[model samples]
Target chain A: GAGVSQTPSNKVTEKGKYVELRCDPISGHTALYWYRQSLGQGPEFLIYFQGTGAADDSGLPNDRFFAVRPEGSVSTLKIQRTERGDSAVYLCASSYTSTGELFFGEGSRLTVL
Target chain B: AQSVTQLDSHVSVSEGTPVLLRCNYSSSYSPSLFWYVQHPNKGLQLLLKYTSAATLVKGINGFEAEFKKSETSFHLTKPSAHMSDAAEYFCVVSLPSGTYKYIFGTGTRLKVLA
Candidate 1:
């Protein structure tokens, strides 16, 4: 698709399980971002990748949450030992440049039971 | 540290009436501000942005916002509200320097009534 694409639109997993969410950004976009949105709250920044390097990962909740953009095109967010509180919509966005307006994906909904 | 604050959590307006959604930001220097709208089960869409070129920014769907530096605000407005305008609105801010990560405000749910 032309817009950002996210896989596993919806995932249900038990606590302590591992999960990975994938995001395919628009072609040629160099800046990609990951955000987590909980119910009744705003999307929280998770990580940002510029090209193949992670420019910032300050917002990751803990060591259990990690993301990687190996080729600067597709990125994946990994969660280890997921907890019930980890349930939220994981949103992926990309921009032509770091300061440009972002184009977002429909988001991957993760439910931890 | 930069942050965005959306004043209203919920707003209800009748059809054809004016609509207002307030947003405020805290930044040491000039920042890039934006307003985005999200429909049910849809991705966030940009309504407009303020990049220091003009204070009054016009956006799609008859939406517009004005940047007030002294007041530190960027409020979204529309002359006449339509049923289609009902959605969740988010205010975002990105610093010109540094990480350039967008900071989003808690969304405001707009309800357009008949």
Candidate 2:
């Protein structure tokens, strides 16, 4: 069985540029989550989606971050006017439901120069 | 609000020795505690979880965590350390119900030496 997966394992971009990271969740997972992990830190929640609807986005850092899950299986995290502070590994995880055990994907490492 | 604290940022142990990674949590209610491990170049893997089921929850790879309500701790322990056990471990906490909003602690990097 395929676990959650992300595209563009590594992305390097200049500051002020826009970037998009994609995540493909496990089939039948109704809950998708996005988190960010800075070096030497644990993953911090960003946004959570439940079947095409965002159940929570409070963890999003600010207006510069946004995420969407249109069909409920795949999601994209978009960043506007990227800053060097945003340079970190963006992780995606999915679960059967909001309270179920989560399965994580190999994070997409974004390097903002 | 729910939060987890990993007391040690790094722990080193030799193979065949006991391994203990301390973690403490704070939550308004009974919390769902979990221990996850991540090897270099790999995603996080669920080592074990402690719901309301049992106080001593056993997880994969001979790892276990005992949920202590009195002490507000759910520390992970393993009898024998293996070289492969060298990885970053995270202690996470969430509410028992509702949205299951998670709060992760700063990771503890394990070094298993031979």
Candidate 3:
């Protein structure tokens, strides 16, 4: 893909339901990142992947949130039990190097009702 | 620890007037700063970045930012505002530490009046 690609541009789910958001990074990119942006707020870091391993997941808020990049190309963000507060736009970005400029996706707007 | 602060939550400017959006940051080491813009219904776009090599950094859409280490600031400025420039801007800070996580500011909404 010419840019990072995210699946299900919009997702509406009931509270307490499980949901999965996918991200497909640019070709050959070594780093991927996930962020959440609430309405009218800046993006908040969620997790970062260096290759296939999650190098940083400190920003995952709680244990219910998990993300994985098995083959280092596509990644999935899973929320075990969604809450109303989880409603936000989930953004995915990829970079050739960890310190390089990031290319963002259109993002998946999650609405937990 | 690293963090970014956007001084103004909202700024209004008439078209063709100068535009200024203030930002400040705190970092323990030499930091990399960036400015990102978000237009309605669009993905976030990189406006500019300061990587310690230059104090002034130019970006797309005629936007620019200056890195001021002393003041811990990286403020975005445009000589002239355009109606298309009305959008939300965010200031970001990244430390070179092994993690490479970026800290983003709250964001500033720029309103360009015709």
Candidate 4:
């Protein structure tokens, strides 16, 4: 794609429901990142991927949040047993390297009821 | 480890007036700093970035920031504030966490009053 693209710009789900958010990164980009933004806050790092493997997952918060970049081009963020606190904007970004500007998606606003 | 601190949680400025948003950072290495802006329903857009090169960096929308190593600050400024400039701004410092990982500040919400 021309830029980072995310699916289901808005998602509404039950507290216990599992949800999957998808991201398609910019073509040929080698790094992908996931972030979560709460109301009135900046984006928090959730994970980082270098190619198809996750280089750092320390920011995932808890096991309930998991992300996968299967082919190094697209990624998915999966949440299990969602909670109301999980309502926030999930952002995806891609970069050509680890030290350049990042291209961001419009973001997926996940609302858990 | 690296971290960024946005001095103000919110800032209000009259339209066409000068604007300033303060940011400070901590890092173990010569870090890369960046400023990102987010409108109501849009993605984050990079305003500018400061690597180890220039001390002053200019960005889109007539915004600029100066990287002060001694002060550990990268403050965003504009000569004139526009109503369209009202948005949330974030300061980010790249961490040596093995990838393109970043430590973001809490963010400053800019409000331009007409």
Evaluate every candidate with DockQ and list the scores.
Answer: 0.69, 0.79, 0.64, 0.68
TM-score preference between candidates 2 and 4, better one: 2
Candidate 2 regions with alpha-carbon error over 4 angstroms: B96-98
Cα RMSD, model 3: 1.3
Give lDDT tens digits, candidate 3, residues B1-111.
678889999999999999999999988898888899988877888998888787999999899999998999999999999999999999988887333688889999999
Global lDDT scores for all candidate models: 0.94, 0.93, 0.92, 0.91
Model 4: DockQ vs. true structure: 0.68
Docking class of 1: medium
lDDT of 1 by residue, B32-114 (tens): 99999999999999999889888999999999999999999999999999999999999999885334688899999999999
Which one wins by lDDT: 1 or 4? Answer: 1
Model 2 alpha-carbon miss at residue A69, Å? 1.2
Worst 10 residues of 3 chain B by lDDT: B93-102
DockQ of 3: 0.64
The parts of candidate 1 lying over 4 Å away from their true place are B97-99
Model 3 clash number? 0
Off by over 4 Å in 4: B97-99
lDDT of model number 4: 0.91
Pairs of residues at least 3 apart in sequence or in different chains that clash in candidate 1: none
Tell me the TM-score of each prediction against the true structure: 0.97, 0.98, 0.96, 0.94
Model 4 Cα lDDT, one tens digit per residue, A7-107? 99999999999999999998989999999999877899899899999998988988999999888889999999999999999999999997668989999
3 or 4, greater by lDDT: 3
Provide the TM-score of chain B versus the true chain B for each model in turn. 0.96, 0.95, 0.95, 0.95
lDDT for each residue of candidate 4 in B16-61, tens digit (9 for 90 to 100) = 9999999999887888889999888888999998877889999999
Report the TM-score measured on chain A for model 4: 0.97
- lDDT over C-alpha atoms for residue B102 of model 2: 76
